[model samples]
Target: MTSARRGGRPRSFRSARRVRHRLAADLALLLVAVAFAVPLGWLALASFNEHAGLRTSLPHPFTLGNFQAVLTPDTTYTPMFNSLLLCGSATALTVAAATLAAYPLSRYRSRFNRPFLLTILFATCLPITAIMVPVYGLFVQVNLIDTLWGTALFLATAQLPFAIWLMRNFMDGVPTVLEEAAWTDGASSMQALWRVVLPLMGPGVGVVTVFTFIAMWGNFFVPFMLLLSPDQLPASVSIYTFFGSYGTVVYGQLAAFSVLYSAPVVVLYVAIARRLGGGFALGGAVKG
Candidate 1:
């Protein structure tokens, strides 16, 4: 340290270098933010603009027709209802299964857990496209095709591996001393989990629930493959009809449809954000 100081690089000079590096990082992040925000900004702008096709221009008439166009019975309302039911059911199932599965995995010490966790991590990365063929065949044999509930179940299962992984981490973070007290009070594991652990882990549960709902809400291919009937289709699949293979698209109506279709997911995110406001903290669960 003395030798370095003798080399004439003072502490103030090093601090100045650090400040410059931080400023450079801030500038780089600002550029990246702009890159991401541009498309979203355009979408919002175009949604209000009449006839805003592929070419971008200010809304001459500045009409609300796009919103009006997409809010019809068949285009928005029915499909939105279907999406809510499907996504809500799937998120509930995923959280329940994850909570139960995580409890055992978090509490138990076993030689198999590391490998099981690795397998789950691997499964999380598996693309839906790669697994669809066997999934389709299995559904056909089990009579699950064309059923909305069946589709929701599959979506829940597909989201399970990651959910289990996340829930396990949350469960592990909760101090075992709390559970010990519950056990001392003659409470069963389930009772302790319900009364103690869950109440404390609200933020984590909210995170998993919101993410699972969003994933299922925006899922297009799974429902399209499973739900054969027109009326049964969710908004994600229904929205595709607005675009064309030959570049003949309804840009104005499509933008409106996209915004309307996206509202539920946004609302869900906002609600969850409020729930997770202070972040996940175990607080005074353990008395030092």
Candidate 2:
């Protein structure tokens, strides 16, 4: 009876301890989540407030004037449009270029392959800021500066190494037997790639698309340096223009514009989140 009572007490103690640990962990996670969410919540609330109201410490009445100000013709829609255009074109180019480059890397194994792959990986590791001056000078000499095409070309090239690496990793997971069978059935190399390999690469393709879009969309420094004209600037540069070197910052407008700017990205992630997980997993699997 004493042994049974002893066992019961110990078991109860452990159970209580476990419950306390779980409760502590849950509380920690909840606190962390709240910490992360507060800024976003504040930003959202600030976006709807008036410029005068934004300076206050407490919650104030909301207005759409900030968003209205952002939407006005004199503000920055043209730059936003330019950014969208450049980013879209750059993403398409990256996808095409990466796909082509990846196939060769995945399918062929020559003595030069390792060195070439290493070179790409090395390029990916280097900061673009390191080469910014030289790239800008080359663009100026070629008279490509301030052009959307030029910006797109630069963005595409910068993203190429990472994109190729990602695509090659994805392609490595694909069975070569499928391509061989296609070849046996009189399918050309292009046909096999298009009909067989590509369909299986949907996840990797989606991952690449997301990466390219986000990178190009958010890039500020390159666009700021290359694009002198306001009309040619991207959304990121336009956001900077909202701030002045003097006093009295337009916090309301800035917040409103930021919220609006983030909408597309939020929508994109919401739309692709389901696919992103699988795609990322497959891409990583290929690498493994």
Candidate 3:
């Protein structure tokens, strides 16, 4: 009877302790969630409120004027177009170059491979700000400053080292036998990569593309510094226009523009969410 009592007491204590721990964790998570949700809630509510301030509250009298005010050609349309053009081109360039650069590193074992990869990894850690001054000078000398294509090229180069590392890791997951088989059937190295390896690693490509696009899309400093003409400014830089010179801000319009600016990235993620979740699709590919 005494031993049973002792065991029961310990078990009860453990159960109570577990319950307390779980409750604490749940409360912490809720607090974290609320922290993020508050800003988003404010953004949504304030966009429709004419008298929006730095608070989250429902619009007493909702209006579409905020969206209407920001939908003009110069304010929204041209900047959106420029963002799409610049980011889209840069993403394509980054993905293509990363893939080609990663292929040999992933496939062949070379004495220099580890050193090269380490160098690339080190490059990713270097902040863009550190190199921007030299980059700006180089751009000026080449007369590429203020050019969208030039900015896109710089964006691609900036993103490449990380992209190459990511691509190599993904490429490693693909079986070399697939490439070997393609080569046996008269396919060249590039042909095998294009036809066999790339098709298999669709998720990797999608991830890289989305990552590069989103990064460049949200980037303000590089574009602002490189492009002199307001006509060439992306939505990221154009967002500053909502800030008045005398410390006033068009809060409702700013919130509305923020929603629109974020839409494309959300849409892109939704479009590829299924494929990314599907993963490598490599099951049974190497089966005997």
Using Cα atoms with residue i matched to residue i, what is each candidate's TM-score against the true structure? 0.84, 0.86, 0.88
lDDT of 1 by residue, 148-199 (tens): 9999999899888888887888788888998899999999989988999999
Candidate 3 matches the true fold with a TM-score of 0.88
Worst 10 residues of 1 by lDDT: 279-288
Residue 31 CA displacement from its true place in model 2, Å: 2.9
Off by over 4 Å in 1: 1-27, 244-248, 270-288
lDDT of 2 by residue, 243-277 (tens): 66656678888888888777877777777677655
lDDT of the candidates, in the order given: 0.83, 0.81, 0.87
- Estimate, for each residue in 112-139, the C-alpha lDDT of model 3 and write its tens digit: 9999999987777777876788889999
TM-score of 1: 0.84
Task: Give the range of the ten consecutive residues with the poorest summed lDDT in model 2.
Answer: 279-288
Better of 1 and 3 by lDDT: 3
Question: In order, how many clashes per candidate?
Answer: 0, 0, 0
For candidate 2, the TM-score is 0.86
